[model samples]
Target: MGFGHANAGYRRLFESDGLTFGAGFPLTGANRSSPDVDAEIRLAKHAESVGFDALWARDVPTYWPRFGDAGQTFDTWPWLTHVAANTDDVALGTSSVVLPLRHPIHVAKSAATVDRLSEGRLVLGVASGDRDPEYSAFGVDPDSRDEAFRHRFEAIRACWREEYPERESEWGSLEGDLDVVPKPTTETLPLLPTGNARQSREWIADNGDGWLFYHLPESTLESYIADWRELAGAKPFVIAVRVAFADDPTAEPEHLHLGYRAGVEWFREYFARLEGYGLDHVIVGLEDDDAERALSTFADDIVGEF
Candidate 1:
C-alpha cells in the first residue's frame, strides 16, 4: 500500500463518515507522573483491544517542573516501537513532536523505522517547539523556529519519499549520496501539522495530511472547521480532549480544561455533535483511577455511538 488510501494509520483515522477516537499515552492522571513501563504497555494493549483507533505518545525531551506535565515520560520512537510490538492495529502517533530542536534526519529515520515496523501504522503530528526554555537548551532561537520547523518538516518528507534526496536545509544537506534507510511502509508518512506549527493556513493545506488542533467550544469549533474546510477541503481535523465520566449516567456537562466533565450519555451527544460539525478524530484523555474500566466503558458507551 502507498501513502494516501493505503496508509494504515491515516486510513483508520480519516476513513468513513464520522469521528474516530485515540488515547494519549502515560494515561496517568497526576502531574509529572510516569507509571511502570510494563503497566503502560498493558494499558496500551487494553486500549487497542477495547477498540481505540490510535495510541499517542508525547515528546518531552526534558521534564520541566514548571510545565507540570511529564508528557508520557518516555522518548517517542522507542516507546512507539515497543507499543507496536504489543498492539496489532492501533495507529501509533506522536501527540506532536517538536521539530525545531531536533535534526530532521534523525526524525526521518526514526519515524520511518516505526512505520515500517508497525506495518504503516504510524501517523506523525509535527509541531513547532512549545517551550521557550527548550529552545534555549537546544541552542535554537525561538524566533527562527518558524523557518526551522518548515525546513525540518520538508527534510523529513524528503527522506521518507526519495532515494538519496539532494536537499539543502539549515540543519544539514543531503548530498544525494547517502540514503535514509528503511523507507516508510508507504511512500511517505502522513503529517498532521499540530496547532499550526508556525505555518500559515495555506501552507498547512498544501502540505499537511491533516490538522491537529486543541479543544474549543462547539460554536467556536464550527467556525474553525468552516475555515479549515474552506482552506483545506476535506482533510481531517483532529483534536485532543479530556473527558471524565460522572457516576450518574444522565449527569450534565460541566466545563473542564480542554474538554468537559459529564456522564457517558452527555458525552455521547457531545461527540455526535462533533462528528456532525465535520470533526474527523478525537484523541481522548481520561482521568480515571480504574484505567481498564474507564477504557471499557468508553469503548462500549461513547465510541460505539460513532
Candidate 2:
C-alpha cells in the first residue's frame, strides 16, 4: 500500500464522506470552564457512538495571557490516554502538539503508549509552536523554536527507530544507554505537521506524512493542494474547520472563532467543494458555547445529511 492508504487506521478517516465531526475544548479559560475528565471521556464516547470518524485533542501548554483560546483544558498525554480507553475504533489524535515545548523522548514515549493502548489508532500532529509566552515560560528561546523543532523531530524519529540511538541535540542527548519504551505499533507514527512552522513548503511536503491546514477558501485550497501534491508525492492531506449547527437549517449562522458563520446548507456546500478539491479528510470543530446543542445538531443534521 502507498503512504496515503497504507495504514488502516489512517485510511478509515479519509474514506468517510460528508462533514467528519470532532469537538474542541477540553480546556478551561477565562471565558470558558474546562470539561472535567469524566465529562470529556463520556463526550468522546458519545461522538464515537454517533459515528464520528475521529477524536481530536489539542495542547496548550501555557495559556499565554494574550492568547485567548485555551485548548483542551488538560495535559495532552494523560487526557489522550483516557480518551483512548473510553472509545473503541475511533481514530484518536492531537490537532497539533507543540513540539518545542517538551522533550522528544517524552513525545515518542507518550505517542507510542497511546498508539499501543488504542491498538494503532493514533495519529500524531506536530507544530513548531506559535506562543512566545509559552516558550518563554518553559525557558526556551522562541526565536530558536524552528531549530529546536527540527532537532526534536529528528530525535523523535530516532527514538522510535534506533534502540538507544546515540545523538547530541540542544534539547538533550541519548547516549546509547536506553531506549524509549512502548514502541509505536507502526514502523513510524503518521505525523501531520500543521502550518509552515519555519519549514519550507517543499520540506513540509517531503517530510510530513500528511498536511493539517486550517480552514481555507475553496479556491485557495485547490491551489494549495495542487502545490502539495506536486511536491508531496501523493501523501494524504487534512483540513480542520470550526462549525456551528442550528436545528433550523435556515437559522442565521453565528460567527466562529476559527471559522465563518454558516448554516447547514452552507456547510454542505463547502464540504462538497472540499471533496472536489482533492482533500482526503476534514476535522470539524464546533465552536458554539453550548456543547450539547452543537454536537446534537451536528450529528442529527450534518453527519446523516452527508
Top-TM-score structure, candidate number = 1
The whole-model C-alpha lDDT of candidate 2 against the native structure comes to 0.75
Query: Residue by residue across 1-306, what tens digits does model 1's lDDT show?
Result: 123534899888887777899999886554386768888888898999989999998888988888778798878999899999998999889989999988999999999899989999999999996877999999888999999999999999999889999999789899999999889888888988999788998999889888999999899989999999999888899999999889998999989888888989999999999999999999999978987788999999988887
TM-score to true structure, per model: 0.96, 0.90
Residue 14 miss distance in model 2 (angstroms):
3.4
At residue 292, give the lDDT of candidate 2.
Answer: 58
Q: Which stretches of candidate 1 lie over 4 Å from their true place?
A: 1-6
Pairs that collide in candidate 2 are 26-72, 26-73, 27-72, 27-73
